[model samples]
Target: MSLDEVRDEARAFLSDHFPKWRKENNARGDLDFEQQRSWQRYLYEHGWGVPTWPIAYGGRGLGMLESMVWNAEKVSAGAHTFFNLVGLGLAGPTIIARGSDDQKARYLPALARGDEVWCQLFSEPSAGSDLGNITTRAERIDGGWVVNGQKVWSSGAAESDRGMLVARYDTSLPKQQGLVYLLADMHAPGVDVRPLRQIDGGAHFSEVFFTDVQIADDDLVGGPGDGWSVAMTTLTNERMSLGGGFGTFAMSFDEVVDIARRTGRIDRYGLVDIYARRTILDVLNNRVQSKLFAGQIPEAEGSVIKLLMAELGTLTADVAIDALGAGGMLAAEAPSAQQRFLGSHAMHIGGGTDEIQRNAIAERVLGLPREPRPDKEVPFKDQLRS
Candidate 1:
């Protein structure tokens, strides 16, 4: 089918099976796990879930443009905004780029069908901003490897089947050189998952503890020392995934505009400035998102896109508060209005903190001198963490 036809078909499918599934409303705040599975199965059957993924590994094999169209259509149709964000957007791409053939065959189909969820095993108590300083260790065992460490802020692990884990494999080597990336079995004997209740009163993110957990040799993504490069693939996918537009939610710019007009605030001097800023950001965000979908931007530019999104999100939320006044903070509203602000607040904390993203922009994108690090050369085991 042509790209346009494919997009229309996908939208029609969502309409029939999930008419209320708007982009922003798709998350549904952890309700109805069965329905989530049912919807995912419906998309998989229609070949719409992972459209641009390779066909050999249970994907639709569509082109990049088709995938972009599919994404845009999902948002336009108000399908679920956060459906399969981590699995399809981040972990799926990373595995395809660096995972072994066996890994692909074993995991891709399940992930596409939303049967086996995956979470990132990056980030730790001390390694949040300085990812290279991770102290998680994986010792070569008799047949595979034994992992013992802690990883926090792991999104979607509470229900995830597997985790893409990074650990220190060779302390004799340099910090970055000794790294190794592996697909950790979340249900392994020594693996423990603790759900963290966030300020939003949700448990989407979790802390994973691995104590002498074993991973088979085949679970490794790349060579032992290639973990750093392999990790870049995952982070690149994270930025791309985050920088894209959300189409699944029902409320959109058009709806927002309509509301402004109805409330007699479209041209109100104060509201006009708010709408103008949002309007400008909406346009710029779309353009950049298109570039990302087309693969026009380099991996390093991921930080730039992330920074723009963070700033835009902050501005948009401020505008909403100004326009809605007290009602914006209310927990109840028309079917969709209440959740709109809930989603906007999450934009700042998800993916990475705005401050961390700015550091990435400064050091990676602009080629500015990196911030000073006194422990850049320290051994992973020696770093003090309270």
Candidate 2:
């Protein structure tokens, strides 16, 4: 089928399913587990869930433009691709790029179908953006490796089936050269997941502890000492996945304008400025998406999108509240507005922090002086920790 036909069919299906399903669940947040699973199964059956993957792996083998159209149709219908964001977007693509045939055959279909969920175990107490600084150790043994470590800020770890893990396999080498990436079974013995309470009253972020947990040799993604390269694939794509929606600002902008217009506060809310800024960002985001569709990941584009989105979301929320006017303070959208404001705070932290992204844009994208890394050449055993 042509891309437009595929989108039209998807639109018809989503129109039939979404509105009633959303009303039944009353979920302003993410859909519940069963609701998500049923929808995912429907999409899988229709070959729409993992559109970018090969047909052999339960995808539609769609081209980039088709994939874009499919996502647009779903979003326009308010149908989310819930339950498989991490699996399909991050883990699945990374596996396709780096995993072995056995690994791909074993894991890809399950992940695509949402039978197994995955989390990332890259960050630790001492490592967030500086992932090379992680202290997680994996000791080589007879059949596999035994791991012992604590990973913090793991999203969805509490409910995950597996995780993509990076641990030090040769502490004798330099920090970045000693790492290995592995697929860890979250349900394996000696694995512990504890959720951390956040200011938003959600415990989605978790602490994962692996005490003598064993991972098979076959679980490795790239060869030993290749973790950094393998990991960069996931990280780079993560930035795109998180911020690609900035191109769709018009929908959100229209919603905000409608609320203000109904409340009769459009002039008082300084919406003109909001409109101008949002339109510029929307155009920039479109260009970024076009580059993405053409297979050129333009330098600094993701960082630019992420930074602007964080700034724009916060600004939009504040303006929306003001636009609601005094009597509208107690309006139905007030709580949702407050929730969105609080949620936008996380956009600055997740994927990569604003400070980290700005530094990346400065050093890597722009022709700026790179920051000095005293430990870049130091052996892992001798490297000083700040």
Candidate 3:
């Protein structure tokens, strides 16, 4: 179908369906968990939930442009996409790229239909930026693997049904080697999730602990020792998703202008600066999407987008808070300038830290030399001992 047709269909569907669902569910602002699930199921039944995915996987098999149009129309209609973004943005793509046919058949339909939610179990207390330093271990056992470790800052983990987990399977090998990627059952016997409350008073992030958690051998996403490569794909997509302006704290140039005008800070915060930054972000996103549609990975470009997005989010929040002046100190029941300012800090830390993105850009994009690592060849066990 043409892009315009897709947009029209999306607008009509939302106009017809969303209000009824909202009214029936009594959803005023942000949706509750059950409301999000019901809404996603409603979209999926109508073939609009994941239109970019293949038809066999429960989508309409639409191309990138059509998917973008549908998303724009949904936003214009004041509808939210599926709340399980990790499932849609990270896990689903990684599975499509690296999963076996059986894996895809078993997982994709439920994921696309929003019957199951997924989360990332990559970072740990010690491995936030330097992911290669993770101490999580997945020991080989009869009929499956046994995991014993903890993951921190896992978004939506408390609500997830599954998680993409990277763990050390053979610690005798180097830090980046002898690892394995597995699909973990979040409701397994030994798995525990503890939500971490943020400064914005939201418990959107969590700490996930595993103690002798059993994962079937069939849950492996790739061959043994391929964890690093497989995880790189997920991380790259994560950077792109975060940088594509899907963030909770994203503010458009028009919104900033309106806020400035309302607060009489139109002259204090330069509208020109906000407009320029927003334009740059849009151009960067377009370039990245074009490259992706052309079947290119654009890994380095993802880093650039992530870095710029982090900076822009912080800058926008700063402007909003400054414009609000003393009024920012007062808390509102809904998300306000103060909440956005507090939440913007998470963008810098999640999807890899700003410093990590800068280093990646410097080395991979600019052809600069990599930083020295004396322990590059050290075994994982030995590194832990030190």
Highest-lDDT candidate: 3
- The model with the greatest TM-score is 3
What is the overall TM-score of model 1 with all chains considered together? 0.82
Give candidate 3's error at residue 175 in angstroms. 0.9
TM-score of each: 0.82, 0.89, 0.93
Q: TM-score of the candidate numbered 2?
A: 0.89
Residues 220-337 of candidate 1: C-alpha lDDT, one tens digit per residue = 9888989989998888777766645552222444555555555554535644554565565456556765675676865545555555555555544454444554565665533244
Q: What does candidate 3's lDDT look like per residue over 159-202, in tens digits?
A: 99999999989988988997899999999899999999889889
Score residue 309 of candidate 3 by CA lDDT: 75
Over 4 Å off, model 3: 23-26, 243-248, 333-335, 384-386
For every candidate, C-alpha RMSD to the true structure in Å: 4.4, 3.1, 2.2
Q: Which pairs clash in the backbone of model 2? A: none
